[model samples]
Every structure is written in structure tokens, then in C-alpha cells.
Target chain A: MTYCVGLLLDAGIVLLSDTRTNAGLDNIATYRKMFLFEEPGERAIGIMTAGSLSITQTTMARLTDAIEEGDSPKSIMHAPTMLQVAEIVGGMLSDVTSEVSAKMERMSQNATASMIVAGQRNGGPMRMFLIYPEGNFIEATADTPFLQIGEHKYGKPILDRVIAPGTSLADAEKAVLLSMDSTLRSNLSVGMPLDFAVIEANSLEISRRRRIEADDEGFSRMSAAWSEALRNAFQQIDPI
Target chain B: MTYCVGLLLDAGIVLLSDTRTNAGLDNIATYRKMFLFEEPGERAIGIMTAGSLSITQTTMARLTDAIEEGDSPKSIMHAPTMLQVAEIVGGMLSDVTSEVSAKMERMSQNATASMIVAGQRNGGPMRMFLIYPEGNFIEATADTPFLQIGEHKYGKPILDRVIAPGTSLADAEKAVLLSMDSTLRSNLSVGMPLDFAVIEANSLEISRRRRIEADDEGFSRMSAAWSEALRNAFQQIDPI
Candidate 1:
């Protein structure tokens, strides 16, 4: 299980993801689910993945390999536009999923994954997309400016209420974290430390990147505060 | 998609269910999902359904028929204990599900449904059981005094945060309504009007019952208040 959320706001893009992965209740492990691709001023892309670890890891490795090959059409760094970059990632993800699912077919196991791709290139707009396992994707628009993957429902109400295109980079970060906080409380599978990143609009660079550990004081304080505030809010509603 | 939740508290039990039913987005209708049985002063049982409507309807019908037949062992009203009442409901639900699935098997359609059974008999302890389609069930305990079925995740966080065995009946009512409010906001399949019922512990009868319509002023007020309070709560947390 995993929980990853990405927001494409006017100020920037915000992405957050948990690190826990498990094959079963007893086979739990922590694995980084967020990948950052940066060429400093040239381009910066953040990819947060959910679903099969094998498929996502392989997809990430292939994307990195394509980038290291230098100026290849398949490399996201050299892609002409953010749309093209999404196409490349979606294509690679679909291929990896098909291959993995084929191999696991005999065991009746499913191998599929999806990703949130958000970034900007030198003169392009800050854009974000949710890439599905079938290689298809959807872009975030002003009306719906956020995308979430894995263990999403428990945390969705807050995002549904608070997020919009004009929301500030600071508030967007808070919304995603509080959203993640709700998920963490209800679901044992989505664990910490968390990987968080923000890309300022038009910057073509990752402005802020953070890894929030379970014991991190700031994250703890915010989570506790959110819980207390929620209880207070709940109490404020009149009983029918 | 549907949403129904039941809680067993020291004060009694709280049960709530939405009235929406749909075959698909285009094919939607209103259908009651909560049924109450009370030989008032003797026992009070509330059965909330989710999943296949055909199966649930049949199960409820059979239970009603058995009760009307007067003192049959299969009749929940005649069952010696609340556990036996659960068994009767579970067995009927499981049988209906199997029969319906057999009829739908050629089209590869599933016909399973689940239920939350909560109430108390004249001499029995207040109890609530979640009955699965397989005719097996699990009772709620002090550690986890709630049961939910159908599109449950969106509504779960509030219940997890606020509900406990010692919670007062009024608070329990508020918790379930707010929980349903979250689900209604996130899921189009769970709609209004809602059916709510409460039974006081050791009373052997329902204490309160209400039908909350879409225009129900008090419910609308609470829903609006909850959204506003949540936004305020979200703003109160410090940004990282």
C-alpha cells in the first residue's frame, strides 16, 4: 500500500509520497517511492509512484538510463514538452507493467503501477499528469488541480475541500501533508518517512525537497495540531 | 456504490445508511438500505445493507416473511439470542447471494452483499455484528466499536478518530452523520436522503429514528458547518 499526492497550483507544484511497501502483512519494507530528475535550470521533474514496486523501480531505472544516454528522444530531459515527457514515462510504465504482469501470470499475481509526473521545462508552464498503468494519462486542470494515487480515499476529503489552482505553494504543501496525515492515521500500510518536493512556477528547478521521518518534530507537531483541530471542529458541529 | 455504518456504544447503537442505488452512473435510483425489526420492549434489530440490491432485498424479504410466520426458528424475532439472530440473517443473506450469483454466473456478474446487524434482545447484551456474504460474521468489541460497509474508506477517518465504546449516543449520532457526510462528498454513489436510527442499551427498543432528506435544514446546517470547520482546521496547522 502507498499514498502519493501531487498538486499543480499557480505558485508551483507540490508532491508527497510515503515510503512503505509490502507484499503481505508480514513482508513489510520501506522503499523510496519518489524520484527526482533535475538538470538545474534546464528542467526538473518529480515522479511519485504507487502500486507494484518492481514495475515502478524498473520504470524509474529505464527513465534514468535513457537520460544518462544523453539527448535521446526517449529521455525526459530532452523531451520537447511536458506532454512528451508524460508520453515517454507512460509508454515505459506500460511496457514494464505488461512484461512483469506476463511473468507473474502463472502465479496469478498482478504487476501494475501508476505515477504522478509534475515538472517544467525552460519556457514551458508548470504541468502535472497522472499516468495510468495502461500508458494513458490525464492532466490536472484548474477545476481539478490535484492527483492522488494509492490509499487515497481516507485522505481525500480535506484535499477536495481546500485545494484549487490559486492556492499558495505554502498552503498546498500543508494540504497534502494533512491529507497524508489522515491516511497515516487510518491506514497502517502507508508509512513514513515521507518524500516531499515543491517546484516553483516557471523556475525549471526543484525549489524545496524534504524527507520527513516518523520522529521529525515539525511533521509531528503539524500532524498533532491537525488532529486536535479536527476534533475541535468535529465537536463544533451540532448533533442532529 | 453505497455507504452504511453501524456503531455499538455503551449508550446503545447508532445506525445510518444512504438511499442511493445505481447500476452505473447513468442508471441511478433511490432505494432504502436500512431495515428495522422491533418487537418493541422485546428486541430491536437494525440491518443495514450494501452490495447487490437484489440479494439484499431478497434477504430482507425472507427475514420479514419468517417473522410474520410466528415463532419459527428461522425468524430473527424468535431467535434465542442476538448471536442467533445474526446467524439467521447471515444464513439468509448468504443463501440469497449464492442463488443470485448462480443466476448471474453466465454473464460473469457478481451478486455478493454484506450487512451490519446491530441490536439487543430483552435479556441479552447490546451487540453488533458485520455479516459477510459467506454467512460468517464478526462482532464489534470495545477496542473497535464500529462496522461499515460499501464505499467505507472516505467515511472511516472520522469514525476512527471520534468513536469509542464509551461515546454518548448523541455524539455517536453526530460521528456517523459526519462520517456519512464525508462519504457523500467524495462518492456520487452514496446519496440522500439518509436513514438514521438509534437504540439505547438495555432498552430493547429503538429510541430514535429519523429520515434526513437532502433539504433537511438541520443536516444541511451541520454539513455546512463541518466543511467550514474542516477548512478552519486545515488553516490552523503550520506549513512545513
Candidate 2:
């Protein structure tokens, strides 16, 4: 299981993902699930994956290969708009998922994955999308400005209450981290060493990319603060 | 989809269940999911269910029939202890689940249900059991004093943070309600009205039972207050 979230706020886009991946309880491993593509000042795209690692890794490899082949119609870096970038990524993800699932069929195992794709193209509006295994995707809108994939439920209430289109990028980052905190505490499959990135709208550049380790002081302090605040808030509610 | 939670605390037991049942997005109806059986002043048992309607309804009907039989050894009212009561309920639930699943097998449909049983018998300690569809059950312990069924994940983080064996019954009630409030906000399938019940330790009788309609003023107020408090809490958390 994994937990990755992307928020599309008026100020920018915030993305966070856990690094833990496991085939089973005994075969746990840490793998980076966040990928960034940038032609600074031209286009910046962030992709966060959750689900079968094989499929996501293969998809990423193919996307990287396309970018290296420069001018390939499939390369997301050269795509005209954020929408086309999503389409290119989704297409590759769908193809990879089908091939993997076919190979796993004999073993009766599923090999599908989903992704949160968010970024901006010069002169284009900031956009975020949730891509399904079938290659289709849905964009976040003004009313619903966030997308989450994998082990999402335990951490969703806070997002539902705290996020909105006008939320500042800083607050957006806090919301996603706190959401991840709730998930990390409730589930074992989602572990530490988080990849976080902030993309200031219209800049077409990745502003901040940080890897938060298990012992990171700032994160620990923030998580502790959120938990204590929640307890205090809970205590303040009038009993029925 | 449904949401039912049972908490065992030093002061007593608190149980809450949503009243929604659906075959699909377009087919939904209201159905009570909480049941109480008491030989007043002797033993009090509260059962909350989630999953296949056929299986759960049939299990409830059979248990009710056994109770109506008065002297039947299979009757929960005649059970020797709270553990025995859980066994009787689990056995009936497992049998009904199997029968219903077998019947639905022709269409490749699966039928299974789960339950949370909480109560205290005269001279016995307060206990809560989560009965699985396989006739196996696990008791809530001092360290983990809550059992939940149905759409439980969305509401679980709060319980994990605040619930303990020593939590007061009043606080436990607020915790479960706030937990349910989280689920209600996140899931459309888990709806109102709700069924709530409380059993005080050693009382051997349900001290309070209330049906919370969607328009209930106090519940509405509590939900609003909770949302406000949560937002305030979110704002107070130091940004990372």
C-alpha cells in the first residue's frame, strides 16, 4: 500500500508521497515514488505513484526514455500543455499496467497502479490530475482542489476540512504533510522518508524539493503539534 | 457501505451505527444497524453490524428467534457469560453468511458480514468482541479498547489518538460521535439517521439509547462545532 497526495491551490501545487513499498509484510523496501520533470521556465511536472512498483517503475523508465529521444511525440517534457502531459503519462501507465497484469495473470495477482500528475506549462493554468489504471484521468477543479491515491481514507478528513483552491502553498504543504502523518500513524504499509515538492504557479519551476527522513526534526515537531492540537480540539467539543 | 463502532472503556461501553444500506449508488435505503438484547439488571448486550444485508438481517432474525424461544440453549439470553453470548452470535452470523454467500454464488456475488458485540454480564467484566464472518472473534483489550465495522478507516485515526481503557464514558461517546462525523463527511454511503447506545459498567442494562435523525439539533450542533474545532486546530498547527 502507498499514500500520495497532490493539492492544486491558487498559489501553486503541493505534492507529497511516502517511499515505502512492499510485496508482502516480510519483503518491505523503500523506493522513491515521486518523479520530477523540468525544463525550467518552460514546463515543470511532478508525478507521484502508488500501487504495483513494477508497473510504475517501467512507466517511469519509458517516460524517461521518451524524453531522452528528444522530439518523440510521447515525451511529456515537450508536450504542449499540462493536459497533453497527463495524456502522455496516462497512456504509458496504462500500457505498462496491461503488460504487467498479463504477466501476473498466471499467478492470479493484480498489477495495476495509479498516479497523481500535477504541473504547469508556461502561460498555462496550474493543473492537477488523478490518473487511473485505465489511462483515464480527472482534473482537480476550484471546488475540489486535491487528489489522493492509495491508503487515502485515514488521512482524508483533514484534507476535506482544510483544503481549498485559494489556500496558500505553505498551508497546502502543511495539509498534505499532516494528512500523510495521519496515514503513517494508522497504517504500517505507508512508512517514512517522504518526498515533498512545491511548484509555484506560473513559474514553471520546482521551487522546493525535500526528502523528509524518519528523524527529521521539523516534520516530527509538526506531527506532534498537529496531534496535540487535534486532541485539544476534540476535548473542546461540547458533549452530546 | 456502513460505519459502526464500539468502544469499551472503564466507565462503560459506547456504540454507534449509521442507518444506510445500498445495493449500488442508485439504490439506497435506510435500515437500522444497531440491536440491543437485555435481561434488564442481569446482562446487557449491544450488537452493531455491517456488510451483506441478507446475511446480517438473517443473523439478526435468527438471534431474535432464539431469544424468543426462552429456554433454548442457543439463545444468547441463556448464555453463561458475555463470551458465550459473542460465541452464539458469531456462530449464527457465520452460518448465515455462508448460506447467503452460497445462494449468491450462482451470480458470482459474495455475501459476508461483520459485527461488533459489546456488553457486560452480572459479575463479569465489560467486554467487546469483533466477530468475523468465519465464526472467529477478537476481544477488545485494555490497549485497544475499540472495535469498528464497515467504512471504519476514515474515522479510525481519532479513535487511535484519543481512546484508551481509562477514557470516561462521556468522552468515549464524544469520540465515537466525532469519529462518525468524520465518516459521514467523507463517505456518502454511511448516512443518517444513526443509532446510539450506552451501557454503564456493572449496571447490566442500557442506560441510554437514542436515534439521531439527520435534523437532530444537538447532533447537528456537535457536528458543526467539531468541524469548526478541527479547522481551528488545523490552523494552529505550525507549518512544516
Candidate 3:
């Protein structure tokens, strides 16, 4: 299981993902699930994936290969808008998923993956999408400015309460981290060494990027503070 | 779908469940998910169920019929210990599930249900078990003194942070209610008109029972207070 969240705030887009991947309890491994496509002032796209590692890795490889070939309509780098980039990624993801799922079907295994694509093109509006295994996708709306994939429920209550289109970029980043923190505490399959990215709206570039290691003092302090705050909050509530 | 939680504390057992049932988004109804069986001074057992309503209702009917027949060993009233009562309930549930599932197989429908059983019989220690659809059950231990059924993840983080065998019954009740509140906010399938009960250890009877309606002022105040507390807590956490 994985836990990744993307928030589309008026100020920017915030994306976060954990790197833990496991085939089973005993076969856990660390694998980066965040892919960045950048053209500095032209375009910047961040893709966070969850589900079958094989499918996601293959999809990423294929997307990268397309970009390297250059000028391909299917390449995210050449896509005219954020929505077109999402379509290109979704198309690649769907193709990879079908190819892998067909082979897995013989053994009754699942090879589907879901992804969150967030970014902007120079003249286009910043956008975020949740792409399903079937390649179809839905964009984040003002009423629901955040999208989450994989092991989502444990971290959802907080996001449901805090995130909004009007939220500041800083607050949106904090919300996604705290959401990831809740998931990490409750789910073993989602672990440390998280990838976080912030894209200031219309900048067409990742304004900030971070790789939070397991022993990062900032993350530890934030996590401890959140826990302590929750305990205090719980204690303050009146007993029935 | 449903969300029910049971917490075993040194002082007592706290059980709470939402009363919503839905076949789909368009077809939803309220159905009681909590069942209480008490011989007052002799024993008290509370069963909170989730999953297929047909299987759970049928299992409840069979257990009621068994108890009505009086002297039978399989009857919860005659069970020698809380563990035995769990076994009796588990057996009935498994039987009903299999019967219902076999018939549903023709239509390719799922017919499985899970339950949380908490109780104490005279001369026995208080116990709580999470009974699986297969009839096997696992008791809550001092290390993990809480059990949840149905849409559990949304409500799990708070319980993991606050619940323990050493927690006070008052605090335990608050924890479960807050947990249910989280689930209600995140899941449309788990809704209002909740059933709550408290059983003091060794008393062999429920000490308190409340049906919290949607319009209950106290519950509404608590919910509002909790949401405010969470938002305040989120704000206090340092940004990453």
C-alpha cells in the first residue's frame, strides 16, 4: 500500500508521497514513487504513483523514453497544457496497466496502479488530477481541492477538514505532510523517506522540492508536535 | 456499510455503532447494528455488526431463537464464559453467512459480515472479540484494547493514539464517540442515530446506554468542538 496526496490551492500545488513498496510483508523495498518532468519556465509536472510497483515503474520508464525521443505528441514535455500532460500520462499508464494485467491475469494477480498528476504549463492554469487504472481521470475542484490515492482513509479526516482552494501554499504543504504522518503511523506499508514538491501557481516550475529521510529532525519534530497536540486536544474535549 | 467501535478498558467496555445501511448511493436506509443481550446480574453481551445486512440480521435472529429456547449450550445466555459466548455467536454467524453466501453465489453477490462482541459473564474477566466472517475470532489484548468493524480506517488514528486498557471508561467513551465522528465525516455510508453502551467490569450488565440522534445537542456540540480542536491542532503544528 502507498499513501500520496496532491493539493491544488489557489497559491500553488503541493504533492507528497512515501517511498515504501512491498510485494508482501517479508519482501519490502524502498522505491521512489515521485516522478518530475520539468522545463523550468515552460512547464513543470509532478507525478505520484501508488499500487503495483512494476506497472508504475514501467509507466515511468515509458514516459521518460517518450520525452527522450522528443517531439512525440504522447510526451508530457511537449503537451500543450496541464490537462494534455495528464492525458498523455494517463494514456501511458493505462497502456502499461493493461499489458501487465493481462500477464498477471493468468495467475490471478492484480497489476493495476493509480496516480496523481499535478503541475502547470506557462499560460495554463495550475491543475491536479487523479488518474485511475483505466486511464480516465478527474480534476480537483474548488469544493474538493485535494486528491489522495492509496491507503487514503486514515489520512482523509484531517484533509477533509483543512484543505481548500483558498488555503495558502505553506498550509497546504503542511496539511499533506500531516496527512502522510497519520498514514505512516497507522500503516506499515507506507514508510519514511518521503518525496515532497511544491509548485507555485503559473511559475511553470517546482518552487521547492524535499526528500524527507527517516531521521530528519524537521519531520520528527513536526510529527512529535502533531501527536502531542492531538493528545492535548483529545484531553480538552468534554467526556460524555 | 457501517462503522462500529468497541474499547476494553480496565474500568469497563465501551461500544458505539452508527446505524446506516446502503446498497448504493441512491438506496440507503437506517438499520440498527448494535444488539444487546443481558441476563442482568448474570451476563451482558453487546454485538455490533458490519457487512452484509442479510447475514447479520439472520445471524441475530438465529441467536435470539437459540436464547429463547433456554437451556441450550449454544445459547449466549447459557454460555459458561465470555469466550464461550463469543464462540456461540461466532458459530451462529458463520453458519448463517455460509447459508446466505451459498445462495448468493448463483447471483455472484457477496454475503459476508463481521462483528465485534464485548461482554462479561459472572465470575469471568471482561473480554472483547473481533469475530470474522469465517466464525474465527480474536480477543482484544491489553496491548490493543480496541476493535473496529466496517469502514474502520478513518476512525483508527485517534484510537491508536488514545485508547489503552488503562484508559478511563469516561475517556474511552469519548474516544469512541470521536472515532465515530471521524468516520461519519469521511464516509457517506456511516451516518447518524448512533448506539452507544458502557459496561462496568464484573457488573455483568450495561451501566449506560444511549441512542444519540442526529439532532442531539450534546453530540452536535461535541462534534463541533472536536472539529475546532482538530483544526486548531493542525494550525499549531510547524510547517515542513
Candidate 4:
């Protein structure tokens, strides 16, 4: 299980993801799920994946291979728009999933993966999309400016209440973190050493990126504050 | 689909369930998921069900028939302890589920249901059990004094944060209502009007019962207040 959220706000795009991956309870391991592609000032694309690690890692490798073979039309860095980049990634993800799942079918194993692709190119608007395992995708709009994948239910109420297209970059960051915090409390499969990134629209660069460890003071303080605030709010409600 | 919660608190027991049933988005209807049985001063039992309505309704009918026959060993009303009552209900539920599922298998339909049975009889302590479709059940203990069935994740975080064996009946009621409120907001399959009941320890009778409709003013006010409180709490948290 995993939890990843991406927000498309007026100020910028915010993306966050947990690092835990497990085949089973005893086979737990930490693996980075966020990949950043940038030609600073030209383009910056962030991809956060959830589901089968095999499919996602292979898809990432193929995308990286395309970028390494400079001038390839399929490379995310060369895509004309954010939508095109999502299309290319979705195509690659679908191919990889089909290939892997075909082989795993003999053993009755699943090899599906879903991804959130968000980024911007020079002169283009920042856009976010949730790409399904079948290679189809949906872009976020003003009415629904945020997208989440994996263990999403526990973290969705807050986002539904607080997020909007005009929300500030600062507030968007807080919302995703709190959203992640709720998931962390409710699910054991989603664990820390989280990858967080912020991309200011039109800048074509990641403005802020951090790897929050288990002992990170800022995350700890924010989590403690949120818990305290919730308890206080719960206490304040009129009892039946 | 349905969402039902049962809490075993030191002061008493709290049970709440939504009444929505749907085969699909177009086939939505209201059907009660809660059934109360009491011989005031002798015993008080509440059963809240989720999953296949056919299985649950049939199970309920059989239990009722046993009680009506007077002194049947499998009758919930004649069970010696709350645990025994859970066993009787679980056995009936499993038998009904198996019978229905075997027939439905030809049509590729599901016929499984789960239930939460909570109550106490004279000389017995308060007990709450989550009975599975297989006729097996698990009782709630002090460490985890709450049990939820169907669409549970959306309403679970708050319970994890606030519920305990020592939580007052007033607070327990509030917790379960707020929990139901969260599920209602997140899931379309779980809707109003809802069934709520409270049973005080040693009373052997339902202390309170209410049918909260969509137009209920007190419930509406509480829902609005909760949403406002959550938004305020989200705003108070420091930005990452």
C-alpha cells in the first residue's frame, strides 16, 4: 500500500509521496516513489507512483532511457505540453504493466500501477493528471484541483474541505502533509522518509524539495500540532 | 452498501447505522440495517448489519423464528451470555450466507454479510462482537473498544483518536455520530436516515434510540459545526 497526493493550485503544484514498499509484512522495504525530471528553466515534471513497484520502476527506466537518448519525441523533456508528457508516461506505463502482468498471470499475481504526473513547461500552464493502469488519464480542474492515489480515503475529507484552485502554495503544502499525516496514523503500510516537492507555476523548476525522515523536527512538530488541534476541536464539539 | 459502528464503553454501549441500500447508483433505496431486541430488565441486544441484504434479512428472519418458537437453543433471546448470543447470531448469519451464496454462485452474485452484535443480559458484562460471514466473531476489548462494518475507513481515524473504554456515553455517542457523518460525506452508498441506539450497563434496556433524518436540525447543526471545526483546525496547522 502507498499514499501519494498532488495539488494543482494557482500558486504552484505540490506533490508528496511515502517511501514504503512491501511484498508482504515481512518483506517491507523503503523505495523512493517520486521521480523528478528537469532541464531547469526549460521544464520540470514530477511523477509519483503507487501500486506494483516492478511496473513503476520499469516505466521510470524506460522514460529515463528516452531522455538519455536526447531529442527523442517521447522524452518528457521534449513534450510540447504537460498533457503530452502525461500521455507519453501513460503509454509507457501501460506497455510495461501489460508486459509484466502477462508474465505474472501464470502465477496469478497482479502487476498494475497508477501514477500522478504533474509539471509545467515554459509558457505553458501547470497541470496535474491521474493516470490509470490502462494508460487512460484524467486531468484535475478548478472544481477538483487535487488528486490522490493509494490509501486515499483516510486523507480525503480534509482535502475536500480545504483545497481549491486559488489556495496558496503554502496552504496547499500544509493540506497535502496533513493529508499524508492522517494516512500515516491510520495505515501501517504507508511509512516515512517521505518525498515532498513544490513547483512554482511557469518557473519550470522545483522551488522546494525535501525528504522528511522519521525524526524530522518540522514534520514532528506539525504532526503534534495537528493532533493537538484535532483533540481540541473534538472536545469543543457539543456532545449529544 | 452500509456503514455501521458499535462501541463498548465502560458506561454502556453505542450503536449507529446508516439505512441506505443500493445495487448500483440507479437502484438506491432506504432499508433499515439495525434491529433491536429487548426483554427490558432481562436483556438488550442491537444488531447492525452490512453487505448482502438478502443474507442479513434471512438471518434475521431465522433468529426471529427461533425466538418465536419459545425456548430454542439457538435463539438469541435464550442464549446464556452475550458471547453465546453472538455465537447464535453468527451461526444463523453464516448458515444463511452459505445457503444464499451457494445458490447465487450460478449467477456470479455475492451473498456475504457481516454484522456487529452488542448487548448485555442480566449478570453478564457488556459485550460487543463483530461477526464475520463465516460465522466466526471477535469481541471488542479494552484496547480496542470499537467495531465498524462496511465502508469503515473514512470514519476510522477519528475513532482511533478519540474512543476508549473510559470515554463517557455522551462522548461515545458524539464520536460515533461524527464518525457516521464522515462516512456519509465521503461515500454515496451510505446515506440517511440513520438508526442510533444506546444501552446503559446493568439497565438491560435501550436507554435511547433515535431516527436521524436528513432534515433533522440538531444533526444538521452538528454536521455543519464539525465541518467548520475541521477547517479551522486545518488552518491552524503550520505550513510545511
Residue pairs in clash, model 3 = none
Mind giving the per-residue lDDT tens digits that candidate 4 earns over A1-240? 999999999889999999999999999999999999888999999999999999999999999999999899989998999999999999999999999989999999777999999999998899999999999999999998999998999999888889998999888888889889999999999999999999998888988899999999999899999988988898889864
Please identify model 1 stretches exceeding 4 Å from their true place.
Answer: none
How displaced is residue B43 in candidate 2, in Å? 0.6
What range of 10 consecutive residues in model 1 chain A has the weakest lDDT sum? A231-240
Cα lDDT of model 4 by residue, B47-92, tens digit: 9999998898899999899999989998899999999999999999
> Distance from true position, residue A152, model 2, in Å?
0.6
Query: How far does residue A3 in candidate 3 sit from its true spot (Å)?
Result: 0.7
Tens-place lDDT per residue, model 1, A1-240, is 999999999999999999999999999999999999888889999999999989999999999999999988889999989999999999999999999999999899788899999999998898999999999999999989999999999989999999989999889989999899999999999999999999998888889999999999999999888879988998888876
Candidates ranked by DockQ: 2, 1, 3, 4
For each candidate, C-alpha RMSD in Å? 0.9, 0.9, 1.0, 1.0
Worst 10 residues of 4 chain A by lDDT: A231-240
Q: Which stretches of candidate 3 lie over 4 Å from their true place?
A: none
lDDT against the true structure, per candidate, is: 0.93, 0.93, 0.92, 0.93
DockQ of 2: 0.91
